[model samples]
Target: MAQGVFAITEQRDGELRKVSFEAVSEGRRVADGLGADLTAVVLGSGIEGLAEELKKYGPDKILVADDAALADYTTDAYTNVLAELIQSSDPAVIITGASAQGKDLSGRLAARLDAGLAMDCVEIKLDNGNLTYTRPMFGGKIVAKVEIEGSPQIVAIRPNVMDIVENSKEPAIEKPAVQVGDLKTKIIEMKMETGDKPELTEADIIVSGGRGTGGDYAAVEELANELGAAVGASRSAVDEGWRPHSDQVGQTGKTVSPNLYVACGISGAIQHLAGMSTSKYIVAINKDEEAPIFSKADFGIAGDLFEVLPAIIAEVKKLK
Candidate 1:
């Protein structure tokens, strides 16, 4: 009988991603409800040490698929190992973070297993004792609930959407043998950008700039660094070459659901709102009180961000 909840933890450069912990916490809740054990699977090279970290958030067991071939993420390698684990465990439910890696791996695994998949789910709940997934639709204008009808339901949860609850369990470690087949693609080299601020998709807080910055990112970057939050940009800011495309948050860019989102001088275009509307708390700062951003913001300040940001920075610094 299929009996446990499984969470697939993603790792890059031998470090577990933030979303991995989020998935494990979510799985722990589901597993406790079902009165079953929760298992966490981490894929990487020389990352068996990460299994102990996952245990802090509570999982009955941790499966580490560590090998040289698994050092870099390859579609074929991760897919094969996960498919093998799923077939053997036959878990009641499988959850992963709806990240680039998560989306890629889960979709392929779903096809391989012929399982129902809920992608980019913002909420997962037990309604009437049935698994239900809630996700945004139509460019964040609407949200819909999804329910997978059978066991081993697969769900890819949106990053930073769920709270990480610590339930501390001494998870037993298992070193699984993953047969990595000959791959069409292999990692030759990997490059990483080490930034002072947090990753946008995984940040608990974010500070974003817009065209009003006049291409001056100094203040915006300072504020973000002060808060230890990620720096994001509006489409206009990116288009104007004030920020890189990677820092853009919007419909045409990346979606972010951080706990606290700060918008500086953004007018809140529909495309921009589509990406960050799911943010838990929004604070907008613009000289124009009539700006569209104010409509969705929890707090609004009418002032020049150039002047206002420094004052806010001063106050934030005083606290430090």
Candidate 2:
């Protein structure tokens, strides 16, 4: 009988991503509910060390694919090997974080295996033998619950959406030598942003600026540093060349589901809301009280961000 719940780990430069643990934690819940074994799969050359770390979160098995070609993630190579693993193991569920890499791999796997798919799931619940996913829809205006039919249901959960739990279970190790050959799409070069602050999507706290900053990120970046929060930008800020496209938080940019999201001088367009409306706590600082941001904020400050940011940063530094 099919009895596996697989969590596909995401790694960059041979290190496991935070969302991989969250997937394992969620997988543990589903495994317990369905009485199936939980397995963690990590793919990269010399990534056995990363796979070994999965034991803390309680998986029944740890499968590591160590190959030099797997060092950098390429769509065709990942899709090919992972598809082969699923076909041979015949898992009941496959969970991956809906990251840049995850979105690509999960969809390809679903198509390759003829499995059902759910994307950007905020919550995963097992009810009446069905796995249901809750996600935002229609530009964050609607909450949608979805379920997939058939075996090997593929779920791509949003980053930071699920919490990881420690169970101290040591999962058995397996090093599968899946034949990974030359691929059509190869990673020639990769440029990644590096900093002490957490990544925008993975951060628990975020401070975002908009057109109101007048292309000055000094105050905004200072506030973010004080709070140890990631920095984000509205589309206007990116368009004005104040922030890079990577920092943009909206429909045209990256989606973030942080614990605390601070919007400064942002008018909160629907496109912007689509990316960050699901944040656990929202604080909006804008001079315009009638700005759309106020409607979604848990706390609203009807004042200039220039004046407000320094005050908040000082208080946060004191508190920290």
TM-score winner: 2
lDDT of 1 by residue, 26-124 (tens): 999988888888999998898978998899889999999988888888889999888899899999899999999999988998998898999999998
Model 2 C-alpha RMSD vs. true structure (Å) is: 1.5
Model 2 has an lDDT value of 0.89
Candidate 2 residue spans exceeding 4 A from truth: none
Model 1 lDDT vs. the true structure? Answer: 0.90
Worst 10 residues of 2 by lDDT: 186-195
Name the 10 consecutive residues with the lowest summed lDDT in model 1.
Answer: 188-197
What TM-score does candidate 2 get on C-alpha atoms? 0.96
Model 1 TM-score, all chains together: 0.95
